[model samples]
Target: MTELGYAQAPAVAAREGVPRPCLGCGAPMAVTADAQLHADATLTCGFCGRSETMPAQAAAQDRYLRLRLMQVRRAREGMEAPLKTYEMMRASGVFALIVFGAQGGWMLWGAFTTADKGSAVFGMLGAAGMMGVILANFGMMRAFRKLIKPLQQARPPAAPGLAARCRSCGGDLPPVRSTHATCAFCGANNFLDNAAAHDVNALLTAEQQDYKVRASGGKPGDNTIYQRPAHAFYVWGAAGAAVTFVVGVVLVLVLV
Candidate 1:
């Protein structure tokens, strides 16, 4: 037995017989059985015939496959209602802010001009409407933050170059500008027809993993709520509420 990249030498010949090729190097592989009855594997290069072991490499490959499967699941979850809710909340926040600002201006003007009691009533109604809009904006912003919080908490997707694999040969290829490439070994020109496929795959994987984690009771924590940017309307609402209260007070004082 001989040490390879990351595998240790096996102790005895395996009962299961030798594997024809090394899983990692594609060299002729041998199997050995240990006292514990576990089979440890090693490889001898076909051309060089260099003795090498790769049990650790095999274990790592298994882990990678599991991780990729998890990622696919997460991506599917991301395409669901949670994403839509986030978009809706974001749009509503913007709409509420705009409506509040426009109506606030009108209300302020009505407060100053009123020939009759009805005009004064209209002014009070406008003030209430503006307050409602401001509150609505705050609610929308809060909802938006909740929706995107999971995405923000989840790990980012793998870099494009790292995620991509050759479609035809299943080999890791260098980042190339051209989608079509001749495989160095197989002579397949369409080894990976879509260069962006890796990126898309990674994104989907991340989303799927995130969704599973979130569904399993993993959350971004309460701290994420405070991390969200304060909605502008919240500030405006506080200011408008204060101003309205003051103006009403002044009017009462002047009338008395």
Candidate 2:
């Protein structure tokens, strides 16, 4: 039962694959909540007869909304570099389409309409140069698509446990080294022994892996997320192509 005066179900969540080592005896600690639940709970070391108090929120780490929110923020911050790189690549593609597309259209127009043979030959050279630019731009886009593939699939590296929060009022707790903490807001005493802290830290570590996977552009359980910046390149590229075709039609009509 929680402090809210309701009967809570016994936790059947999957155990951390490796058993947490007992702080006292360096043996495997109990995996179930009844054996390891903190908040005035006791865990006796089966190997050494040593008793340890659990952390204040060890059993209820998932229920803390503040802690979960912090995890999300941390995951997004972890992917900041890749996300920024993708956006920069997308912007450069758009800039190239505008500048190169205009230059190419002008060169092709001059090649067709020039009266002097020398000027016409120069315009033809410019038109060839424009075709090369278009091909190079296509190749660059492909390279960028490959560049962000690794980034989108990248996972966050392991990090330290997040700062602990007060169980009663959700206030931040100073580095917890002892067996108890007094919440500044609610004045409720909380348990936070070394064994409990270890368990809680372990939970945070596992949750961070999932959080990072989702934040880096992939859905939960998915290996890759749909990268919007990369997708934008194709979308704008199509639009630019359509505009160039329309301009070509207009030029043909005017020149004929």
Candidate 3:
């Protein structure tokens, strides 16, 4: 028995239904049985738009429908990649170093000033301020790195075929013989002529699935579907910047 508690081979076969040829492209329609017994059956064709209901004894049809659903689930999961730890650490480290250097410069200038006792007190306060900034910057860097590390480490799915289903028309776009090729359905130019092909993979990492789904499409499920990690990065970066700016203002007012 597999993890779902059914025999793997037969259960899979039971889930998959009969194949029907597509009317548009002659591609085969894959069908599967819905888990809910006695429920109305549905069919989904990966290559064309064709669906039909099956009679009660349509075991083969059920299997085909289930297989299609399985494929979709896998594809959706594959779209979301993972975050890399090294990349997160590197970004955070750079931010920390920059903030630390700036604070250090401010402190060094305070040491050289020749003023009265009040000036000396202010100088000491400035030194303390620099230390506080250094610590705060380091903390911020650590927090940001931790938050995004899991996202960076996610693995992407295998690349799709040259001809992919168009988001707008749901039609396949075949590759051009030449480097410059335009999508037949939508007239969108394929990036073949460019240095790299366009990646249609999902943008969010596996760990951020829940957050991405919620923030983006408001999907009720726990999984997230982001088109790109950079989107998440921008959102996080903006929030972090706003917080840092507010903290810096408070500190400057208190110290100066």
- Each prediction's whole-model lDDT (CA): 0.45, 0.46, 0.42
Models 1 onward score TM values of 0.31, 0.28, 0.24
- Best candidate, lDDT-wise? 2
Report the Cα RMSD per candidate.
Answer: 17.5, 17.6, 15.6
Between the candidate structures 1 and 2, which one is better when assessed by lDDT?
Answer: 2
- Candidate 2's displacement at residue 137, Å, is 5.0
Per-residue alpha-carbon lDDT of candidate 1 for residues 1-256, written as tens digits (9 for 90 to 100) = 1112112222223222345665556766544322221333444556655665546756344334433433443443333324444355456755665675566556546655543444444455455556655664665565545554433322222454353443233334445576444332222223343334445666557667867997999875443343233443455456666676567546734652
Screening candidate 2 with a backbone cut-off below 3 angstroms (N, C-alpha, C), the clashing residue pairs are: 55-196, 217-225, 218-225
Off by over 4 Å in 3: 1-25, 28-48, 53-91, 112-256
Give me the displacement of residue 111 in model 1, in angstroms. 4.0
Model 1 ranges with Cα > 4 A deviation: 1-86, 92-104, 115-117, 151-256
Residue 191, candidate 1: alpha-carbon lDDT: 30
TM-score of candidate 3 on Cα atoms, chains taken together:
0.24
Question: By TM-score, is 2 or 3 better?
Answer: 2
